[model samples]
Target: MSPELIKRLTEHQPSLIGLEQCRQAAVLIPLLETPDGVQIVLEQRSPKLKHQPRDICLPGGAIEAGETPRQAAVREACEELLLRPEQIQVFGLMDVLHTNTLMLYPYAAKLTDYDMTYSTAEVERVFCVPLSFFQTQKPEQYRITLPVHPPEDFPLSRIVGGKQYQWRERREDIVFYQYQDWTIWGITAKILQAFARITR
Candidate 1:
């Protein structure tokens, strides 16, 4: 390689492969300071929604074009919770999660002056669970297997073993948290698990 080409390549920042092709989303893990302690604000999605309706989740949605993850998280929280931008103070970003089709950015924020308000069009209800609950209670864990399937047009004969080729299967662990009558699982629980680990 030429010296100039090497220098140019070195200056390029490395990022996740195929990240540009992945669907991006951002969420705010809102924290409410109360007399008891710090509570986590969660929402039940509107049952009429097309996506994960009635599912318990943090306030967030798809990252809009040209919007940063932090901006998306704050905007989603403000829209869903009916709070002013000043009322949602984002402190830090926890971590970025990668799934088969999604790239999720979870931000840690403090919600001020929020009065259990939410948009009925997007959220069915808003509730708070003590941060202590997650800090104290362990989530139930389960593993799921994902088998790889080749498309019908895929040329299996191009490989050595043909149809007998052993494709590696992927497995992922899922977590569930039971807080009172609420069942928190899937991506929401996964993010919470990460948060709990860091806080501990």
Candidate 2:
């Protein structure tokens, strides 16, 4: 095997940044074996939920205390999909992701069985798409630009034109993907995009 492949197989490390109130979370990229081929499992969050209601997502949530992201990923899959631990075989830990405040971990696991009963309170629906679909369909991209303007306070006392200093704007790229009737976008899309590249 190539050195890079070896590294990817061996490096399953976690990172914690030095920041307060920074939540750490994890998600499972549940791949199911089938007669046609391997497929990816995804979930739609319950509309009644407070966060990301009715959004299409992977089965995952916050990493509990004294638990590794790996542990959390499996626990979440079990909790959300009503699957036993033995039915899920975690294969690899992918790269970590960062949000405005949360640090997220993504794990790749294979589902040994197809039968599942998702938690109604947390999962609205469970769906699967062929891995080849993403291999063929590319996501649409958009960019958002935000220019920050500080308040016009009178505290610009002893600086070199502090109030008039030029500042740079921040830009973020948004991606969207359409599969028949579903629009997979945002963080979930990003995770799938990364997984697609890894597969390639």
Candidate 3:
């Protein structure tokens, strides 16, 4: 490889980091073009599964060892949505959301045609919420408190005071957009809300 090519490759490495060990993940925000204009595709996760079961989500999962976030997102879409690589065109990167244990990378893409067979084991149903709805209606937001609970072994000698030291936790908001019967919230809702704001 050329010297300049190697330099650019290293400079473009993913920025995800480990905080109590962050598990990298990626998802595709697919835009379906229809006669009605554009709609954002989403999946109702399989109720049979554990870990946030039955949540509304964009198509994605954990990033595999040999793939970049973009490749992972596209591969996940293919697995969950049964989309061939050629059927969709990736636009560009969206914002990356980092939680306590997960680093999620979401990519914006244009999806063609409604002919799709979703993996029933992974998805309960695939549906589209018209992009216009999100553009017009803002999501309901609620702030929840985060309380810090440190272990008894927490070093006190290093601090100016011992256990008397004051600690604070930041408040985080849980966003919701109720589309008919579906309650889209959490990370999925955050991604949708961000997309709506940017496209508006």
RMSD of each: 1.0, 7.7, 4.9
Highest lDDT: give the candidate number. Answer: 1
TM-score of each: 0.97, 0.83, 0.87
lDDT of 3 by residue, 29-70 (tens): 999888898988999999988978888999999999989999
lDDT of 2 at 159: 65
Native-vs-model 1 lDDT? 0.94
lDDT of 3: 0.89
Please give the TM-score that candidate 1 achieves against the real structure.
Answer: 0.97
Tens digits of per-residue lDDT, candidate 1, 75-154, equal 99999999999998889999788987899999999988889999999999989999988988899999999999999999
Whole-model lDDT per candidate: 0.94, 0.86, 0.89
Please report the candidate that would top TM-score against the real structure: 1
Error in Å for residue 167 of model 2: 3.1
Model 3 is weakest, by summed lDDT over 10 consecutive residues, at 13-22
**Model 2 lDDT per residue over 8-90, tens place:** 87995764555346688889999988888889998889999998898889988899989999999999999999999999999
